[model samples]
Target: MKMKVVCVGHRMPDWVDAGVDEFVRRMPRDLPLQIVEVKAEPRTQGKPVDALLDAERQRIEAAIPARARIVALDERGDDLSTVALAARLRRWRAEGDDVVLLIGGPDGLSPTLKSRAHELIRLSSLTLPHALARLLLAEALYRAFTVESNHPYHRE
Candidate 1:
């Protein structure tokens, strides 16, 4: 099954794209990894944060593939080790459905969206910039795959 990172941001810096591309290139054909960037709602002086998040939530929901397992990335979510992630990845593949990992915008994901996720996970406890988080998630996924495949790219 394929995996997609549905992030609510666009026009990331060149460095972020280059970093993510490196991991994407290494992903196996059987379990391809792709990134889906949704436009972030513009923040205005009078607009409430909730309104902006709601707009992003709609875009995120629309970007998700039908019947796909949803995983929301949140700072408060479970933090899995690389090995644990590999096992989780294996389980996801066995389930025979595409998986989508949701990364929220600057303000974060709405409670409603997070509640709908099949799993909630975090890359770190510290709040990371969205661009950096994107790169980290891409590399972590690549490392998890390597661990699963017993490749030298990952080590205990």
Candidate 2:
């Protein structure tokens, strides 16, 4: 069965493309990957960061597919080890559902989106730049898929 990964993120600089490309190339050819880019509004010099974050939340929500299984990435979310993530991916695959992973803007995901997620995952307890977070998620997903297939890429 083909698994679909729909990742939502704000606009990023060119540097992020390299890492995103590298990890994406490592994913199995059979798994479909789609990137939904949401444009971030330009921040005024002295505007509170929260305002920007709220705008981001709206953008992220708008990009999500109506029927996809939502997975929000938040610092306060469940912290799962690699093995656990693999198991979750296997379960999702067996259920034959398309998974949509959300990456919020600088402030974070809105309460509504967080509450709507089928699963909320924390990539790291430590805060990371949105661009880097995207790369990490892509790589982790590739690794989890490998583990589920019992590929040598993931050695126990």
Candidate 3:
């Protein structure tokens, strides 16, 4: 199954792009990974936080493929080890539907979106910058892939 990271932001830094590209490039053709960038709603003084999040949510929803399994990344979600993530990846591959991993904008994802996800997971307990989170997600996914393949990229 193909995997897509539907991130609610554009114009990631050069370093992040390079890092994500490397991981994406390393993925096997049978289980390819793609990044779908959504324009982040412009935060303004007058616009409420909920409005911003809702706008981003709409964009994220539009990017998702029909029947895709949604996985929202949130601070409050389950903290998965690499092996656990590998198991989830293996399960997704078996299910044979595209998986959309959502990374919300600055203020985090809306409650509605998170509630609807098939699963919610966090890369770390500490809050990370969006760019760093993207990079980390890419690398983690790559490591998980390796673990599944017995490639020695991931270690205990």
lDDT tens readout by residue for model 2, 1-156: 344333445556787877777767777776756667776656689977777777777777776666778888888888998999999888877777678888876567767778888988999988898888887888888889888888888787
Candidate 3 — what's its lDDT? 0.94
For model 3, state the Cα shift of residue 28 in Å: 0.3
lDDT of candidate 3 over 22-59, digit per residue (tens): 99999999999999999999988899999999999999
Native-referenced Cα lDDT, model 1? 0.94
Per candidate, the number of residue pairs that clash is 0, 0, 0
TM-score of 2: 0.84
Q: Ten-residue segment with the worst summed lDDT in candidate 2? A: 1-10
Where is the poorest 10-residue window by lDDT in model 3?
147-156
Against the reference, the lDDT scores of all candidates come to 0.94, 0.76, 0.94
For 1-156, candidate 1 gives per-residue lDDT tens digits of: 999999989999999999999999999999999999999999889999999999999999998989999999998899999999999999999999999999999999988899999999999988799999999999999999998889999866
Instruction: Quantify how close model 1 is to the true structure by its C-alpha RMSD in Å.
Output: 0.7
The model with the greater lDDT, 2 or 3, is 3
